[model samples]
Target: MANTTSAKKATRKIARRTEVNKSRRSRVRGFIRKVEEAIASGDQALAQAALKAAQPELMRAATKGVLHANTASRKVSRLASRVKSLSA
Candidate 1:
């Protein structure tokens, strides 16, 4: 119940932003999942390649405000470690 016109417009803007954020979040998750799947498959080359692709996407999401910078960096670090261990 947005009583004012400005409130109504703000509500619409929030809804639009929510949808955009959801899409961005889902895209970031997909990239992370690809890396995880590659690691699970025990393909070091594949995991490395996937991480290469995912790192930028994760950082982009952070820049877009969909993820925290530290969170993205941590995810990248953990995934890189797992990928590295695949060769061990």
Candidate 2:
């Protein structure tokens, strides 16, 4: 499908970028899932720690354009609130 040399190069670049982005997305989700699993296990301390670790990963994904900044912030806020409420 990529007839021109430039187009073929572009396609290759896209494939590489797609793989990188997919890895990044999966890593971010793994961090979030750790927080969720900690929360589900009802370990307040563990949940807090997982959320702490996830915050930066979420923000990093946002900065890399994998997620919107607002979405990352909202997720951090919600997770923090839930972690906090676990103490109550």
Candidate 3:
């Protein structure tokens, strides 16, 4: 459907960007899931570590435009609180 050369190029760029974004999103979700698993297992130490590791990944996703800034902040805040409540 992209008749113009510029439109075709733009479509290609969008496809590439979509793949990259999808990968990033999946990676971020994996990190979040790890943290959740740790929490569910009731291993405070592991949960804390996973939360620490995930914080940066979540923030990075937001920076890369994969997630909204406020959404990331809220997630980090809630996770941090949950981690804090866990005994050492």
Name the candidate that leads on TM-score: 1
* TM-scores for every candidate against the unseen true structure: 0.97, 0.95, 0.96
TM-score of 1: 0.97
- Candidate 1, 1-88: lDDT as tens digits: 9999999999999999999999999999999999999999999999999999999999999999999999999999999999999998
Candidate 3, which segments miss by more than 4 Å at Cα? none
Q: For residues 1-88, could you state the per-residue lDDT of candidate 3 as single tens digits?
A: 9999999999999999999999999999999999999988989999999999999999999999999999999999999888878784
User: Which of candidates 1 and 2 reaches a greater lDDT?
Assistant: 1
Error of 3 at 88 (Å): 8.9
| Number of backbone collisions per candidate | 0, 0, 0
Q: What value does the lDDT take at residue 40 in candidate 3?
A: 89
Ranking by TM-score: 1, 3, 2
lDDT of each: 0.96, 0.94, 0.94
- Highest-scoring model, lDDT: 1
Better of 1 and 3 by TM-score: 1
Backbone clash total for model 2 is: 0
